[model samples]
Target: MDEHDRTRTPVAGRVEADDRPAPLPRRITVGIIVNPKHSATLRAYADLVPQLQKAGAHYRSMTTSVERSGRWQAEQLIDWGADTVIILGGDGTIRAAAPVLAEAGTLTSLVPTGTANVLSRHIGLRSCRHAIDHCVRTVASIIRDVPTNLRGIPVNAAEFRRADGSRHRTEFISLAGIGGDARAIAHHHFATGLLGYTWGAARALFVVNFTASTGATVGAGDTSGTEGSASGQVWSVMASKVARPAGPIAVFPQARIDAEAFTVVTVGPIPDRLIARCRAWAGIATACLQGRPQAHPLMDYRCTTDMWVSVESPVPAQLDGDLIGDCLELRVSAGEKKLLVSAPTT
Candidate 1:
């Protein structure tokens, strides 16, 4: 789309002045990657380009289609000399572009324009315009003042090898799952479009036997090494970096952005009772909203750097929010890589 097609009327909201002192010099080059499949991609482009131009920053924009891989497009933008890359899409879109940005070792910004904006929620950025403005201003000020040590949190990237011997890499700012959760994701994918997550949750209810095999080992540790135990009849396994996955799902309530390790939540086999499941769901919801430090009998939380998950039979697995088919052996640990991201100041 042309400049006219990309421009939109700025929301008539007041721009709050930053409390930090102004910088002396300001010059920046910004690139935007838009996922056309996202519901809010068009609106995000319209709302952000004008703000970038008005701020006197050089900008480039590209739209992502199924034919064109998000990672390839992001790499092209970085090669085109983007000091900072801004992405407009959901968690999946971000996952696609993250490794590319991280490989380039560039500071990346995000505009939450997808169904599950988990990363955006974690960084406290509410909208596309908010993220764009924050990125532009931060870059400009960095050029002017050399004293600011403002930096983005580094996050772990995960790689999932499918039962078919194919591997896919994804970045998860929220949570990843295997077993019942993976099956739920697959069901969700088949049942609905972007809104399939609701259907997935419903499917989880009718299905009592979601795990392919209960006897398996779930390993977890840090860059130091992996440590954990084996459990039989695994229900749901979640590894999270942030507190809330999306909405009210707080599987890891004590997770922090700057923590040296990640938290794993594994649900062991239990009686398939509605009341028990409801209680577990309630605990997750309450922890997410109230920041309470409580644990459920079905759920166990452990902190570690590396983890190995082996199932008795082939089970569905997912990285970030994307399904990775089925797998008998899954090894997940903090990869020796990191992503640079922009976050709002507290």
Candidate 2:
């Protein structure tokens, strides 16, 4: 038999052959979590509603605000019987909804409408249009199929507790960090998109005290895998499950979403001179962007399942693009649960 004939499945002795598979018997219900601040997202949603309607799909959408969180909206959707969730924002939005959906085993998707859409881009949802188109197709399927835009995107969960005895645990689907980068997020919270991030980074460069160093400890487990300690003049420390957090820079080149352990990159203890520090920062960034790993006294990289970092003074911290305020100590470990997402497999 030919390729087409062999692939066809007979139903009631009748063969139905087509390039595209028929829609599943049961319809999918989609839950859209939108960031109302973006006009482009609103426009995309407007176009999406009619397409979903034409496709005979059932959907419920809500706007996220400073008061109403994505996690709350996701819970509401789940309560409303939604099995599939679509986030129309960036990493921060995804992180907020992740815990609830992962526990419920809900399939999540993203439209990448916020700043530094690192996770969204890594999963092949490059543009808003691409993400929206995938949503239309997703609502037509009932079962999870590998041939379509469905994937199990792995993410690390972190639990952090402060030295002051206040305990708070949160899940992050993207990069998490302490020091200058986190301070930058706090400074740029008033702005949006790349411009905001740039402004924040610039402001942080001048305002942050780079001469300070923090004590860091990392390990894959209680006693197994890699273990190390560092103390010196420190700049910033970050951890991630992806090769790159934003743009072309592979901050953790050896890392992967599906990997069992995440990679941590530490850059610090450089010359106290501002110009010298700037040169080092630019050089390290350039190397990362080129996907090259080099050995330098000012930089350290390691793969670990758990990391503990503490400083003499509290520094700002951020996870998945959301600031976590000032923290003197942070402990992060890999989570056991893996979230399912609608995206191309890496």
Candidate 3:
């Protein structure tokens, strides 16, 4: 038998003869979550919903504002009997619905609507209408032979308690930082509308400084795995699900989605020379774009299941893409895999 024949299974989860093709559904129900604040996202959905309907698929959308809408969206989608969940926002939006979808054992699709669709790019999904069309076709093909045991990867979701006794939850789909990157994100959040992140990153480059007294202990695979030592005061502690760290940055290229663990990349105290810091950033960017792991003086990469971070003083923490408040003691652990749809390999 050929490879395709070997992999063939009936849509109803039964093994059938090679000559018999599994029946495809006439109408597949999909639940969509949209970011109301993003105009581009609204446009994408306006185009996509009509296309899906024309293709004989039913699309249900939940429009949301900045308020916490992910959990409610997931509940509604499941209640609507959606076969799959489609997220039309950025990493933060995706991260918001991931745990719920994962627990429901439903497949999740990304539309790359946010400003920095970093996770979408990392998974080999291009950012545009063409990519959306490709994703739709792929989902159609898989409907018949829906894998019984869908694979999910572990991700760390951090909970932060503020000094005022209030708690907030942040999910990190890519990388989460506690110092420099955190400050950059915070600055970007508050800056003027135009070129906010760019300006914030630039300001962070000049203002952020680190010393040798701060450090973090990372636990990989089982949280109890071998503990690694710190070289200098950890200016930032990054826990990433994807190999690429975030944005135009890529610190650990060896990390893979299917890897049984997460990559913990730590940077020593801030470098003395500005040029060295720039070089480090450049190195990481190169690694991410090229899909290769590169070594640099300021960074150390390792795989772990659990990580315990201790900072000399409280500092900001971020997950996925949003910034939580300051944390003096932080514990990170790997969670179960969440279902994600990706482009089919040719």
Worst 10 residues of 2 by lDDT: 208-217
Q: Estimate candidate 3's alpha-carbon lDDT, on a 0 to 1 scale.
A: 0.66
TM-scores of all predicted structures:
0.79, 0.84, 0.78
Q: What does candidate 2's lDDT look like per residue over 95-168, in tens digits?
A: 88888888888988788777788888888876889888887777665434324555565556666655465778
Error of 1 at 72 (Å): 1.2
lDDT of 1 at 273: 88
Give the number of the best model, judged by lDDT.
2
Clash pairs (backbone) in predicted model 2: 233-269
lDDT for position 318 in model 1? 81
Candidate 2 residue runs with Cα over 4 Å from true position: 1-25, 143-149, 161-165, 207-227
Query: Which candidate tops TM-score?
Result: 2
Question: Mind giving the per-residue lDDT tens digits that candidate 3 earns over 144-178?
Answer: 55542233545556655554456665455666666
Alpha carbon lDDT at 43, candidate 3:
87
Task: Give the whole-model CA lDDT for all candidates, comma-separated.
Answer: 0.68, 0.74, 0.66
TM-score attained by model 1: 0.79
Residue by residue across 177-199, what tens digits does model 1's lDDT show? 78777777787766545468778
